[model samples]
Target: MPVTHTYNEEHYCKSKRERRNHRMKVGFIGTGSMGGLLIDAFLSSGGLLAGDVIASNRSPQKLARLAQLHPGITLAESNGETASRSDILFLCVKPMEFKTLTDEIAHCLRSEQIVVSITSPVQIYHLESVLPSKIAKIIPSITHSVYSGTSLCVLGSRLEADDRTQLLKLMSHIGTPVEIYEHHTRISSDFSSCGPAFLSYFIERWIEAAVEATGIDHTLAGKLAGEMLLGTGKLLTEGEFTPQQLQDRVAVPGGITAEALNHLRCSLDGVFERLIATTHKKYDEDVAKLDSLFGRDGITRRK
Candidate 1:
């Protein structure tokens, strides 16, 4: 079944029909995982037409794949060309490559153009330093491939009201856009961006345990787990029941579910605390390296 758009999303698309018909161009400087996912989401959602996108990537094969997937999208030969041509540009390259990629296209960027970075470490401060255009950082999630999940957005000071509105509106078509501060980037990304893999790992282990312990078919266990996860996400997002409330409803006192919960509580105590601490530590190290590379005192001075 195809996903239906919200009323607001439908209205937004209808309002932008003239712009789409006139061929408003959205450029992507890299056609990697997140970038490619975004392109597909936007097109599939009717937020942007295939002909309205112009993309370029370091690898020719990626561009070729995108061209095959979306026939009308123009593939630029270089990052600078894509930057120069787009009304709104997405920099989807790695965090380390931000400086080089921005420098490559800085000369061609226009004052009115919207420049967005998809990575978390390369803050808007870094982008604003070189980009002449409006800048922002939007941390996307893997779950957005299914048009679900939250996207963390940190708008730069230079971004105008109109630009911010447009950006958020576009993002809304793919996922709920949550405006956040730069300081919250890492923790928010841990929840929204890195969360899918982390949650999936636990679910995978759960499936494995069920197969190993009960002699259930691995395939059947995986299928059941996946459907349960999907339904659980829906229940949480629907806002009728809090996690604890849901658990209370499902796990009667001394029930199997309650026993399982107790086992999980004992086994997983301090696990997430360490997980978050470890990720934050790595984040700080990455920020320090980026600081050294970009010659900023630190995030403090940049802010």
Candidate 2:
């Protein structure tokens, strides 16, 4: 089945040569939800022609659907074919599949090809040791799909300047990409990658309370809570106020807001503190385990 697409012809034509000059032939191994999102962001960013991107997955059916949706993409039969066809490859597989997949495609990857892994805890050195290509590790959040998330990318010391620039440009469309040390990547994941989930938990609690107090429909309550959070996020970005400053601004002296804030601080401190500490501890433990199993070098595990 042919996929239908509408694009700016003039824009594509003018940019075609420029894109060909600088754009990479990209391949994605694993067309799952996250992989699909990456492809979407890349295409939407333009410059790279549709034919420049290829993808391969374990399930041909999944690839077929993706190819149908994006007619410009070539579907590879195997992981090695995907790696060989592209200048840059993204390993979007699960942590358990990392070693096996890398082993399968190692021989196909060229020394100049750049491989970016989104798998948690699997460090860049593990990838470099297994594959001959230059490697990078990125801790990306689910918000990448929305094109407004944060990604903490740790570039391996072995990567060339051109490859690093290409990576930053490719990922910039999805969100703000921050470069950090390898060890800091794991810590960033604890806050930035998993931060969305933590925020969602609080929003869920807020919605539940709103539903109970106002007798609003559960769905409406959820929407309201989400919008509130969205607005708060925008305010935080636009205003120069720190989090503490924002909190102080909301709590008026001798008022309901102040009373509520006091109650929250007094009653919720122990519970929230314990939850945050436990989450960080668990994240560190997972990183330690990956380092033990994979052997760390450029990719330092957080312990």
Would you list the clashing residue pairs of candidate 1?
A: none
For each candidate, C-alpha RMSD in Å? 8.1, 7.5
Provide the clash count, candidate 2: 0
Report the C-alpha lDDT of model 2 over 1-303, residue by residue, as the tens digit. 121112222433334467568656889999898788788777776635688898999988889998887897888877877887677888998876787787677767666678999866677767766677788987777877767767888887679888788888878878878898876665577667777888888788887888889888999878777888777877787766777888888888898988988888888868856776786676567656766656666554333
Clashing pairs in 2: none
User: What do the candidate models score in CA lDDT, each in turn?
Assistant: 0.84, 0.76
lDDT of the structure predicted as candidate 2: 0.76
Model 2 regions lying over 4 Å from their true place: 1-22, 270-273, 280-303
TM-score, structure 1 vs. true:
0.90
- Local error of candidate 1 at residue 85 (angstroms): 1.2
